[model samples]
Target: MGNKPSFGETDLPCPQPRQFPMLLWLLLLLILPPGRDQSGVTPKAFLLLNPPWSTNFHKDEVTLTCRDSLSPAQGDIYWYYNENLLNKKSEEIQIHKTGYYKCKTQRSSLSDPVHVDFSFDKLILQAPHSVFEGDEVVLRCQAREEAKEKRFYRNEIQIQSNFTLQSVSMNNDKYHCTALVRGFWTWNKEISKHLMIQVQELFSPPMLIASPSSPTEGSPVTLKCETWLPPQRSHIQLQFCFFREDKALGKCWSSSPELKLPTVWSEDAESYWCQAESVTPPIRKRSLRSQLYVQRIPVSDVTLEIQPPEGQLTEGENLLLICSVAKGTGTVTFSWHREGTVRSLGRKTQRSLSAVLQILTVKESDAGRYYCAADNIHGPILSKLIRVTLRIPVSRPVFTLTSPRMQAMVGDVVELHCESQRGSPPILYRFYHENVTLGSSSVPSGRAVFKFSLTADHSGNYSCEADNSLGVQRSDRVILSVTVPVSHPLFTFSPAVPQAVAGDVLELRCEAQRGSPPILYWFYYKNVTLGSREAPFGGGASFNLTLMAEHSGNFSCGADNGLGIQHSEMVILSIIGPPSNKTTLITEGVTAGLLSILGLAVTAALVCHFRTQRNSERLSTTGTPSYSPREFKEPSRTSNTNPQEPLDPVEPQPVYNNVNPGDSDLVYSEIWSTQHTNENSANSPRKHWEDKEPTVIYSDLKKAYPDDSTEQASIVDSDLEDAVENYENVPCVLSALDR
Candidate 1:
């Protein structure tokens, strides 16, 4: 409150001409917030001091100020220090002691207290934020002016005779300054707080490390900056950047310790480094160069090549095999193997990525699948299996004869099984009889069977030959005896080539030639069993049929020995009666109608026969015959391969028949007779027509018999022969022809 020129003063000193007090004051007034007191005048309360806010043991002058926006003063002010009240009208107060001071008014709230540090404390040391190696570092100490001496210490080491702020060409250290006062038996010294100067190794060489240490092409890698500063400067904020030798990479400045790379290509295998920089002082350090060598892709597309590379491996021959890479990168190990082996036949580890395997002599065991493998750290790849085969001449073959009986006989199926013991697969076996090649068969395992019906011609020397790629070997000859069955029985009547009268001595002879000794003969009259006779020696037998109406039927005989039976041709014998008055029984009307129907039926049958023969010839010439059923009402047949399942028999492809009413429509009476007449009938047109494709029509016979009648009936439906089966009808046919 007193005007003692205190440090906290209210009045301002006169401004120099360069300051222009009036303009400066007006500018200050314009900038301050408008504050009006209760007296209707703009007023503000503030404090200013001379020699700043503190005094060093009262060595400097003190002043204070309380300025207002409108005028220096318009209201009464109050001042307080250390809670000591001064004048209520005074606006400023100052004291040279470490204490709180403030100003207040009735309209204005109390201002914040300002504490001035005026303790007897004395030492001060200054250091810069950024310091470099060998740079001048300044350490200052300030204490009471009356102190006899001042000293400085770095890291607790004393430095004598330094009174003013100290300077040295050193960095990165801690220093403390102090003043010693000689007080005649008392000691008082001012010590400064420790001041540390951070020295940056901004020029220290940095090192880089590739994270994962070893990298491969096409895989990602991380480059890290491995560097450090002095322990004292470890806490300083820094940033890092990466570069590919000279080119900057992504985000040159990164707060992260390391930079992540997406991928590395072959071209990325080059030198790289990093730079570390201090943020505050802007110091940068370059890192040591590092090389990144990326490994390329592994081996691919491997193959094995044969040395000779023609035909196949042969027995007793040396073989050379090579396993090589078609395309790949980097080192690889090559290996070879047989099909059924786990261990490699040959293996080599080389940068060339190829290997060779050799066999001194190829044997049957080596005639198998072989392959090669290309292996590396990446994975193993295999080539396709190569098939090697060895060929050797076939050895002498052994012949086997398979027959149902010890002596091959007619009607017996004989099989000659042929095989070679040692030979490559698919050896052909050919059967020969008396130097004549019967047939040839190929067997993969050098085995086959030739089956044929035994005949007298087959009863001779039999042999077989086995052959392969190399050569053929024949088996020695072996005799084969075939027993012939009885030939067709020769049946004859006593009166040869003549009709028999009712009283003629009729004798029938049945004989067989070329049959084994001892044969039994059976005589049939119109398929009726008459009698059987046996000859102790292979010869003829006889049967007697009295010349009567009952004996006037077909006569045939069969001879049977151990071999199968053979039947003779039927013999016809008709009795001619003298013209006389004899009563005959026949339906006039029925007979005429039946005869007309028979004629029509015969004509249709003949027309169908002719058409079928032409169609069959055309079909045979074309080699294509189509077959389709006439009805779809039946259930569809499913296809099956099982032998037990009955096969669907093919239907005859119908051909339209054309016949003139009077030409080529004749049906001879003898053709319908039960008796077999002329020898040329064996090759007769009737028989030939029966063998051709038939005309399938909607006939009543089909409906009458149905498919359920006989076993496995063909599409044509077997003819019943009902008329000729009744031998009595033969007389009627013969009589009609005679008429």
Candidate 2:
């Protein structure tokens, strides 16, 4: 013990290897910067109470230590009470006053608040100042002196002496403790005051904020996560994240408080929110959901379309106008206008890209240029201009027919004119006869004319039609009549024989081939009119004339109708006297031999006696025989016969009938006798011959033979005396010889 060194000179033991490392770490913390840890995260500042008591009597003392992730030597501590700063700079503080207390470090955030209650009461119940969910809690009863047999109760129920809770949370249940104390002479019971505990939130629920609440399409947008931590837990690191509906927008967990979007679209309008969470403690919170809506683009590329496509408008038709835009949305307004109109023709408001306006029964006044406009809160856009025109249809036409004469004759020209009251230009006219197309003509304006020569086939109904491509119009029908003229006529005389007696009857007839009704026929003899007759219906006409001496000249007939007159060839006629019977001689074998000769001689002597007596009378009367009837007049009928032809027959007695030899020659005979009385030179034999003069018979003969020429040779005799004298020169000798 004497050899031991003085107290100040004693040696100390060296530290262990594990303990040396811990000491080295503490040294490094004291020299490093404040707040930030090894991971570059700033830790929150906090305060801790010494002895860990909640409530204390008046004038009681408590110690508060401002703590952070950094060592105390690295940063100074700050203190606050009731949101007021304290002047102290030490890491530890002691106070006897009761109030809300908080603390922070120079390089850290503020800590959570703590309530310290300083009461004047004798007995009180004690518990932790700041309580959180899932934390261990302890309850105690205290008084001015020591107590025994203490008991505690929650709300009104008794609890064990340990007075402990596992995973405690906030509550308003009253907690009290009762204990027995030794007072003056007897043991007294003391009861502590009731207390209630409040639980603090880890961090306020997160709030999401959007930068441009109402955004347009194709523009930028920003989102932020807003939250706050308790002052006591400010050093806790929190991570941020954003989501749309239930899907994450970008990184699931990010340290940034704000999330950025390059562009937003119409499809991006949906529910959105953000989340904030502590990194170590796993305290997570979500913000309230927000809806983001994007506006649509403005109207553009306006256009107008027509319904017919061809743009052809006709009278009494419907017109349609369609206005539209290539890209637009929401409510839209459309307007239609004409070129010269002050007001819009039509207007429509709807949620579609196109609109239509219909005009029923289009007319001529609707023709003009047109356009359309569209708007959707933006300026109006116009479409290209279009023009419309109208056309008119044809109207009923008028047809007329004109001719040169009142009564249309064959070969007359007829004119047809067609016209319409209302129609477009370049009209076509067609003329029809009896519903058959005659001809067609085209004219630019006014009426059309077509002329055609009249014919028998053109005597029917006529109509005309006009067309201008819209429709065809026809006119009422007109009737036509045609007339024909008469042709040459034929004349004929009927008797079937060349010769006829003075009392014979004859017929003359005239006819035409083709003529109108009521034809008049005239009969002529010797170039003089005999009589006239008319055929009512259009055939031949005939006249009857008794044969007379004046009717022996040439005969002809003519036919006359309204059109013209036509004449026929002339025909010769003859009138002759009846035949007489007397004693005659027969030659050709002389069959009546003796009787014929004796009769002939007797007849000759009588003829000689009369001739001698007549000759003596002629000598007494200047030697010329004048054979004349005292009151005889010349016959009015003149013979048209050959003047060289003798009045007597070449045969002793020739026949006057049966004379048709395919030739036109004819024969006839006439006889006349007269008696005279004279007193000078009277002779008996001359008187017998004069008596034999016997009614001097005269015969005119015109003969035609079977072998005669076919040429029609006419013989005309003007003198009646020459024919009688030629007959007297022949015959007295032949007469006496035959007797």
Candidate 3:
């Protein structure tokens, strides 16, 4: 070194500017350690400080050395101060100036710039120009002579004298010192300029790295914990650890810087990081977290399930078809198909294991076998088949009643048939009579029949019901009439006189107690037909005629409906001429009294008969009748119109015959009629009430022929074995017969 220029002078030699500075940067790349200062360009060269302090006395000399990775003998060294060139060629030099200095080599880039401070003041703060992080450092505050007292500060804060930094971190801190020195005889105080300490990094932070960053499932992976240390500190032992989402990937701590994974799965996709620590210094560092993702497995084992469970689904109901996969990952496509259809019923694409397709309203056409398929990146997988059947609701049931005869007579066995036109069976059919259930029957696919024995109560309205689970349907009502056979009738005449003369008027009545409505009655004389009258509303019929000579004979009456005709016992009738004038004149005096007595007696007898018939009817209706099931014989009709007979329906209510009080030859009689249900007859009632046999009561008032004046009245009761008692009162008779 010839002579070093002062830092304040800008004029210096320029060594003929060459392109080597640019070429040097391009040729020799400086690979920096990890976590090296990121704020500036990387430096290929560095400076070594002698005495280690940047601030020193002006008279003190400091040695500087230029160090680089290149060989010292292969390149000459150049030096700069405050960006100005200096005349220096050796790799080492001595300086006593305060300025920023840098160096370069012929084959290497420029080193990082450093600052030096030379002070002429009495007080100075001394610290190293280049200090590494985590290094123990000592600071000194000095004066030209011994100080009586001294004080120091760090970062503008007062600190104790002789302060030492133990394991100091890489921080830029301003330091200064204040010293009290004895100058001549008086004491004086001096303060040094603030110096900022610069700390160099010893090693770089660790970085986490994965070879083949994106790995497939079941594939191997390699993980490395990367870091760098200074060449001087390269011999320091370091330990590394690898982690995934806070869980250790290998041994918690290992000397090896790498971790190997033989196989990875989808669950292994997570945040990963690495840690590096020095064994001697116990310095630890961690890398920033990185994300690792593993590919997924393929879709397989597809299946389809129907909502509402079984195949017993009804029409007009919502249907749900679910498609699922036993194992799959990533985006999946699901499709539902019917066995006989060309297009899929539904399709869905999503990141899920199952998908659903709903049909708002199912119909009969939707009944079929169904299946589903699922796919990912791999091929499609099919599910097992499922059959769905739609049940049809039962249509309005058709209800019908059948019997062996044209009419549903009592004791006849009839069948009630109920069927549904369109529906699924096993259908249940219930038979109803007058809105009340009689019995029930069930069939798999067609009509169902319930056998019922007809009774008087079973004659009203009839209906049937058909039901499946889906819904219930009912049929319209059918009307049935239970026809009953006519019983033997009672024949009688009006007037209480003993006999009837040729000139007297006569009335005859006939009635059948237990027969159905619309009964026909025939009046006969000596086996010859008189005429017929119809009692369309039931109870009885009557005929009126004048007693003539030809009418005197045995009189009888017959009653008939459609079932059968019954005839009454014969009554003897003998007609004579009118009374003699002398006798008539003799009885005429007491005629008023006799007429009153006869009227009272007749009224009493008629009332008693009516009450008895009413009682018998009430008992019959309340009790079950005994029945002998059989068919009744049909009646024959004969036509012989008589001029004396009234062809029209003479009366609908109870008949009352009028009598002439003046006619002493006229006779009146009250008739009581009753019916018997034969035990062997098919139309008989099933059970008799109180176990009582059938009986008929007859009471009559008669008048002898005018030749004799005797008047007779009698009562008779006849019991029929094993017969139901059904009775009715005959019409009252009040007729005047002239003698």
Candidate 3 deviation (Cα RMSD): 26.1
Residue-level lDDT of model 3, residues 596-685, one tens digit each, is 767755754564465446556656997743321211112333432776844433222232222323446443322221222323435433
Give the CA lDDT, 0 to 100, for residue 98 in model 2: 81
Q: How well is each residue in 640-678 modelled by candidate 2, as lDDT tens digits? A: 376675432322221111223335454333332222223
| Candidate 1 wrong stretches, greater than 4 Å | 1-121, 132-138, 143-149, 154-174, 180-189, 198-301, 308-320, 324-333, 340-342, 349-369, 376-380, 387-739
Number of the top lDDT candidate? 3
lDDT of each: 0.63, 0.70, 0.72
User: TM-scores of the models, in the given order?
Assistant: 0.25, 0.36, 0.41
Q: Poorest 10 consecutive residues of model 3 by lDDT?
A: 713-722
Instruction: Give the higher-TM-score candidate: 1 or 2.
Output: 2
Question: What ranges in model 2 sit over 4 Å off?
Answer: 1-99, 105-108, 117-128, 131-189, 193-208, 213-332, 339-366, 374-386, 389-739
